[model samples]
Target: MLSTEADSHANQSDDYAVAPARAWFAFVMIFLLMLSDYIDRQIVVSLFPHLKEEWGLSDKQLGALVSVISVVVAVGSLPVAMMADRFGRVKSIVVMASVWSMATIACVFARNYSQLFAARAVVGLGETGYGAAGSALVNGLFPKRWHSTLLGAFFAASAQGAVLGVILGGVIADHWGWRAAFGAVGFPGLMMALLFMLVPDYKNVVVRFAPKVQSKSPKAFVKRLYAALTHGPTLLWVCLAGAFELILVSTIWAWMPSFFNRFHGMDVTDAAKHAALVVLCCAVGALFWGWVADRLSQRSPRNKLLAMCVLTLLTFAVFTYAFTAHLEVSTQYALILLGSFLMTCSVGVTTSTVLNVTHPGLRATGSAVLALFQNLFGLAVGPLFGGIISDAWGLDVALAAIPSIAILSAICFWKASRSYEADMALVAAVLRQEAAGERVENTAVLPPLTAAQA
Candidate 1:
């Protein structure tokens, strides 16, 4: 019996080998999971017209609903990261999907803006956990060589989901009403969580179904979290870059539809159609950038994120012009596509850079921290801030502010590359010492090294 059980386990391990087929399957799953988040986010914006009409919401009130959701997602990111590190990625996904599924379903009950806002906030909590855990899982599953490519594929799915959510929600709202649209998209997400159960877990180069036990306690988790934040310039810079990127991305997602609807005097369907084109362009851009990053990484890892900085600056200009320009429908379509492609292209680069420098065991924690900062500044500040600006200065002037933010993000990302190179050396050295069975002290601090370190 014991021998037969051992043979069964051996066969299972053998099946876990990195076949191309399996890798592609894992990529598909990651893409699907990412799509879920995009649907959740995009659905709200698509339904905004119906909801505004039904509830008679002011711009300020609607802004509050979006802001509250961002705040919860930002706050939830850190704790979720810690949970991911202490537990496992799969478990985190399970809990997050369940929580968000319920929160989304609860949206059906909310007749007022405040009630709906509260439900959205709860949804944010689940989304945060899912984002951190899912990203880490993708990193762990794929080889280092293709990390950017795989993650880029995942990011591209976000654009696809956005397109689907906007088109589907808008069509449904036109026909059925807003509540059914929410339940229709939100309920399927719960099933995706269940599907996650079939996926294997990756830990220390082994794939297993059972949760791997962690030696670290909650106290240690906190300690490590502090150490990571306070002791690492690379991590700080990367997180800052993420925050900046999110700001631009979030602003675009939250308000671009409104921008089109109001500025072009188009109905929800027409606005969504344009937005769908933008989303498709973004998806294409994401995949292209991922391919570029993976190719460039063979020469220098820094190229991964450096490319992002350059593209972001370009995107800032394109987006600003797209929103501010008073052009014909054809011209408008061209500008939106150009802007989206440039903006989303950077996703693969930025995500790969973060994952590459992060400590192996703390991938999820680090991702969480990045997500938190990004959400706080990007999601929280960008959309609401943009709305306020639109309210005060008009949409054109307010949107001009997006390029400035994007430029700032570009600068931060560029600066982060230098610090990241240095940190990679330090981490590599620490790992080397550990391999030698040396109990190296001062894990938090390392003196400066020559260019060789970089």
Candidate 2:
């Protein structure tokens, strides 16, 4: 099946000239750094109890540690992605990894809650535009057909790192201390940062500017951003769908340990490990469904959004029932695992959807806009609100409420499906413009493509 699918994209052209061996090697390098990225980001979740116990902190404060990173990533990603153009993606990523890794290590020396929170924010700052830079580099290096699958692979790395972080944080904290857990995960990212420099960088896109445009002007940049942000109905709808789905996914990732510990009567380490195991299922599901969505899209491009919508509905059904029914603990865990799997159905495909409709020069910025929505509205909201609601009412209410967004997510994807073909036409015309040696400058803000031109 995989071989057959590989044959489908055999005609897709790669923009970069990386050797096959070198390309795969570069993927391995980037994949590891992405893994390291989440491990550092999520390791603190398993230490929430420790922080709460030691500092006598509120749940909101503990949740703030996780939410702050997403908030920072949301606000900083646009500017940070711009840096990838200036510094080069490979070099920028190396610097990003180094900063985040060092910040993670600095957590070990934090004496108060303020100090620790400051370090986590630094970690967020370092991670700001990594997805945008990394995705753009990977997209250019691989065939067009491979873009969505590779993106799925990238996000699978995120789930993989998260699982490891949650498990390691609990185990190390139990045996050594919470601080040691930080050191253990922190040091490896530094090593990975140095190694990431060995990966090849993609060639930059150089285009003649339109007479009215200034390449280096802040006004030019904002226009470019505005174009990407409001490119078409498909990109807008797809971005919203991905953001809504993350409400459930991030809430689960952030609160899984506490949920297991409280409801299942498990110890902190045991609960973290259990939650990590559930998240490992999430990684598997993301990769598997991503492959399925890709194959479905081969028959019809619109099938991708349809696939996402179906999976999201499945998530809502499973989660709503599991939380509301008086089921056994084992049964509940089983349902939650399935829910986790289905919740991220849109993750990779949505980014790919944005890429398909966006100008190649603005692909990184395009993905960052999705990141902006996902972080600010989805990831940032999930943990903070979960903690607040849990404090105000109960954890179960927060958990159950999060999955309802899946309904809205499905609706958005369905709406996006209607506009997919029209949006792809515009992108196709833009690609033709590039091929014809005509600069399609700021096409995002320009008039729609006619059927004849497309």
Candidate 3:
């Protein structure tokens, strides 16, 4: 018996030894995909001024482009998410990446605002699949213990992508025109997508709460989607949080270049440079939040989410003051940088929180629900609302919405925090019951996926 136990331990060690390399490879691939997604999204923002000038478009028209994409993304995320669960994550990622990249490249050939708008919508549809599929793949690739931390790294890549788009897009647009900028950013993602096919699915080794569960048929898929949308606090809270946050984030990213150029007396390229730096700071904040949350989870599972609530509350003040203040250009820049960084910390916090609370089998579905809220509320409304406010009430008034949204988000997260401890207790009880060979009802209330014996 002792010899058998020693052999089991040796085999477990051998299995675990391959995890680090797998985790790194998965992290790099997901990071690049996320980076590409953000870069694609940011291209519109960076080129807005040129597009507005060349096409003689109004703020409302630009707003429509933003709105249409978000709406499409929201609508597309669900079916794509279901498809991911039903079909295959690797296939979903490849297809989604190809579609979005090709669609974005099409933007270079668009002759009218309508054409561009349609292309952007297609890009959104592609993104819905990309996000859900990539996230599910990431969860499967990492050791269960490292999901949040690796996810944080993945989130950081997105921020880096945004920053690169702002900085590099500006330079590219200035040197070769906005169309070239789009073409350059869009084409590279296709290569990344192709490379992704080389990575095999690691879902087999990664423990899941529903390990033997098979994908639902289309009818069951639709039913599950509906159930997620209609019957749970999970969807509601995620949507609210995503909406408010996206609105603030998108609004700022989409229009900040124009705002800086107009208000600070800077050029487009210069504004882009500044925006890049600010976004880099946000990336740092996001990464830090993830690390902190993961460490905190060791002591209390709720610590991850609780940290987010605290950041949101604090950042609200920072954003309010930054937007409302009248200071020197340098001072204003510093304030904006600091405020945006603090606010972005919530990205990692919210993502990990949502993932942690959701059932393993429902990861793709949960991600879809989040995509809907994020796109509709955050992406669609945030930028368009900011633009409208800027047109009618001035940029200052428009940006004020960010702080208000942040405050509301803080409140919601705080309420969610109250339930975290109880949720943890329930999960622990379920895990214990399962260990004792008793049946557990709700799959969501189980121990962390990694802790389960396969």
> Among these predicted structures, which one has the highest TM-score?
2
lDDT of 2 by residue, 1-454 (tens): 0000011112136543477889889999988998999999999999988888999988788889999999999999877876675557888899999999999999999999999999999999999999888887777678877888888888889999999999999999999999999999999999999988889876554322234443445665555455533447788788789888888888899998988888888889999999998889889888888788889998999999998888999999999999999999989989988888877667789888887776665666677888888898888888888899889988899888878989999999999999897888876776666556564432322332223322
lDDT of 3 by residue, 1-454 (tens): 0000001111112233236676577668878989998888777777878888899987767777767777887888877776776566777888888888999999999999989999998888788756666666666555556666666777778788989988878999999998899899999999999998866554321212333324435554344443322233533564576567667777777777877877787787998888788888878877887788778878977666667777777777777777787777788778778877777766655665565454444556566777778787787887777777777888777776566787777777767666765653543444455446564432222221222222
Per-prediction TM-score: 0.86, 0.91, 0.85
Candidate 1: segments with Cα more than 4 A from true spot: 1-23, 204-232, 439-454
Error of 3 at 221 (Å): 8.6
Which portions of model 3 show Cα errors greater than 4 Å? 1-18, 204-235, 424-454
Give the range where candidate 3 is weakest over 10 consecutive residues by summed lDDT. Answer: 1-10
TM-score winner between candidates 1 and 2: 2
> Model 1: how far is 355 from its true place, Å?
2.1
Candidates sorted by TM-score, descending order? Answer: 2, 1, 3
Clashes of each: 1, 0, 3
Query: Hey, what RMSD does candidate 3 come out at?
Result: 7.3
Q: Clashing residue pairs in candidate 1, if any?
A: 247-378
Model 2 quality (TM-score): 0.91
User: Positional deviation of 383 in candidate 1, in angstroms?
Assistant: 1.8
Candidate 2 clash pair list: none
Q: Tell me, by lDDT, which candidate is best.
A: 2
